[model samples]
Target chain A: MRDELLELVMNKATGRASDEDLRRIDSILELEPHLWDDYNQWHQEIPALRGVICLAAATTEHQHQLPEQIRMKLRARMRTALSRSQPNYDRLMELVNTPPDPQLSWRWAVTPAVSLVAIVVISLVLFNNRPDAESAAQTEVANNQPSEATVSIAPVIQVALLDTVGVTRGADDSTRSQFQKAWPAVEVRQFNSSAEFRDWFIQWPAARGSVCKIFYNQGSGELKLIAKINGEEKAATFALKNDVSELSQIIQQAQARLVEWMQ
Target chain B: MNYPPIERLQSGDSEAWDIVFEWLWPKAIYISRQVLTPLAPSDAEDVVIEAFTSLFERIHKVYSTESLPSLLVAITRNHARSHLRKLSAIKRGYSKTIPMNIVLEEQLPSQEETPLESLATEELFDLLEQIRLELPERTARYIHEYYIEGLTRRDIAECYGVSVHTVSGNIRRGLRVLREKLKYKVICTDDLPFRMRNR
Candidate 1:
């Protein structure tokens, strides 16, 4: 509770406080006059924080060049990585040059063919049910009327398939292509790191309200998948046995479940 | 100076490399110094290099400029943590000395944890310097008297020919300024000096 008050006070000072927060801060200050000293002390520190950040950020512009030795070291490392290409380049090339594993070849070939068929089936269903789709779109449009007139009145279903961490980093090309094939309509975006994905997910404006958020955390050598559709959320966790195959299976399962929920 | 588009950096554009290095390297060093102060300079440099290497491998996913700092810091922090972990493992192999990793990790501030518990006294003093610069001369003096000299409001009021209420108001007003200035950098305030139940 005190933490919440401090947050409110800090927010009020920074001008980020909501009305409720401001009210809370005001009431707290009024009630606990002794606490005012602590508040004053922290409040006074704000300028220093700003100064340090600015000074540090600006100091770089003045005299701090990436030290020559470090730059050289980074360049050499970059050259080495570039020469080697992607970490799995050799493995991928070997897989490409050799015949597909006899056991999986049939499955591999059939996956894309199946996805193509699914895409066609979905398309035909939408086309045949144009009136229904249009009505659904219209209802959606009506529900979002006035403010969203600029949005296309036509109804469209768009789903985003994203990886929160580079859990898919070592995924074989065949796996990637197959996954894309399975979800032809879903727009796929891969996040190579959890931090990158988390930051983007939080700031993503279009994902608010009833949208789906599929989070994948593979940080601790385990795959933890959570699918939040509307207010209901479901999660799965399992130790990743085979990095590539297991991740591929997880993606396929998540895609199937998400597709079911979307349609 | 014209900065290259974020897309170019993501694609391993050679020219964009210089600009990316320039902007991130300093901040990386700053954070590294804070995280690896007791470790060798080489360790901090290694962490920065590791961070950049990871950034390069995953550059394609960095869709925007706004998240660059955060992404860099996260990568740097992870590397630093791992580096410390490795050191701790090595030390445990050889000696009975306390694991340095635990000490370093404890020193590092975590966003998920309470900010107050994590803040070291030196950080507070550093902030005090910033606060002192912005306060009115009289209020700044009083801060030095109260916090530095351990003077009470009554003592300050007696010395300054003001009521205790006036002294409290001056300190509060000065602190309000600091809060406004520092608010952007602060989020979890549970450990803020005034929020302690014992205090």
Candidate 2:
């Protein structure tokens, strides 16, 4: 009876035997009173065994074709066991179907590093160009005066020196020479008022970092000069009544040329 | 109609490959999610997809259909474990280690079980899990899905993008491990039939 019950139980549990096999085991149990303890033990173990069987059957069905009845029974038993023993199928399924977190991926891992490099590069570029940009603006303002009128009259000259001269050793000499040679060719546009000249100076690139304004009275030979270096302004009023030097006229012409070239 | 067997996949019958993929995708995804519970849904999918793509490159050796599930489950577990290793390796300021208990909780069903039943289930799961972790990521995933989650070998092969032969090899290797681990747990010789115990 124990052997028959064992055979029936193993067959039923492994899905190798049919429900009839289980019935056969039940019959053996019914017929033998002494084997009841063993039968009860088998019954106690059935749920876990059934779960394993169901899982195995589900897996085995992929390769070996099982009888439909056996397959159905396994499925039913598995469903019952899994549902009753572990009710978290829905939760597990939901987790399985849930999408993966993108933050953990490699793309996001390097974002901070990438951003830091970008910021540093941008800062270096801006820091290096700031003074060059200011010097260029200052040079532009110095050039915007009328050559005919300013060259003949001695004008009050006000110059503001920069703290540091960022001369790019050999690369900038040619540009400097070019500016010196063009000094004689300077011609400024005539304006009725100093405000007009100031407005035009504001638009000039050289005027961006530094600014200069000249007020000249042809009859009195009086010239008022106001120049700004960086943001600080210096004002000088000069009387050219007694001055007749060629150096003064040359200086005036150079200033006029610088303005014309900038315009 | 000529139904191409698993061995023919490596020779380059794309249609045969497709048929296999269609069968295994859900099971593979299911198994991957079970093993890699800490990963988000998208990450799990990516892991599964990557495993399948890797599997597809070598699908020539799978000779039998019975070994497919085991192969897929093995692959899935290996992939998830590899991901965990990678995560751990890069643990810096923002790294998080998912609790092992939580991972097991997520993977297992959430129902009350008798102590004996739970122990048996745990034993079987532990055996498979250990075997899966030891295999290559793709192979481990194949086994987990096929054996634990019950997906077919053909389906697993297709999903893993491999030929049936390769999938079968994975299954064979996985089953060998499982048999070794589970041998002592078989209390009674009569509890498993000849066919089930033979492997």
Task: Identify the leading candidate in terms of TM-score.
Answer: 1
Candidate 2: DockQ? Answer: 0.05
In lDDT terms, which candidate is top? Answer: 1
Pull out the clashing pairs in model 1: A40-B175, A43-B175, A43-B178, A43-B179, A44-B178, A45-B178, A46-B178, A46-B181, A46-B182, A48-B130
- After superposition of all CA atoms, the RMSD between model 2 and the true structure is 30.2
Q: Pick the candidate with the highest DockQ.
A: 1
Q: By summed lDDT, which 10 consecutive residues of candidate 1 chain B come out lowest?
A: B97-106
lDDT of 2 by residue, B2-109 (tens): 445766555545556555554555556665565567643445655555455434432444554334555554455455554444343233311333222233222222
What is the lDDT of every predicted structure here? 0.51, 0.44
Off by over 4 Å in 2: A1-263, B1-3, B92-181, B184-199
- lDDT of candidate model 2 versus the reference: 0.44
For candidate 2, what is the TM-score? Answer: 0.26
- Model 1 misplaced stretches (Cα beyond 4 Å): A1-28, A31-63, A82-263, B94-199
Candidate 2 structure quality by residue, lDDT tens digits, A107-218: 4335545776998999789767778777677557647754342343233222211101111111333322332343333332333222222233333234344555543322
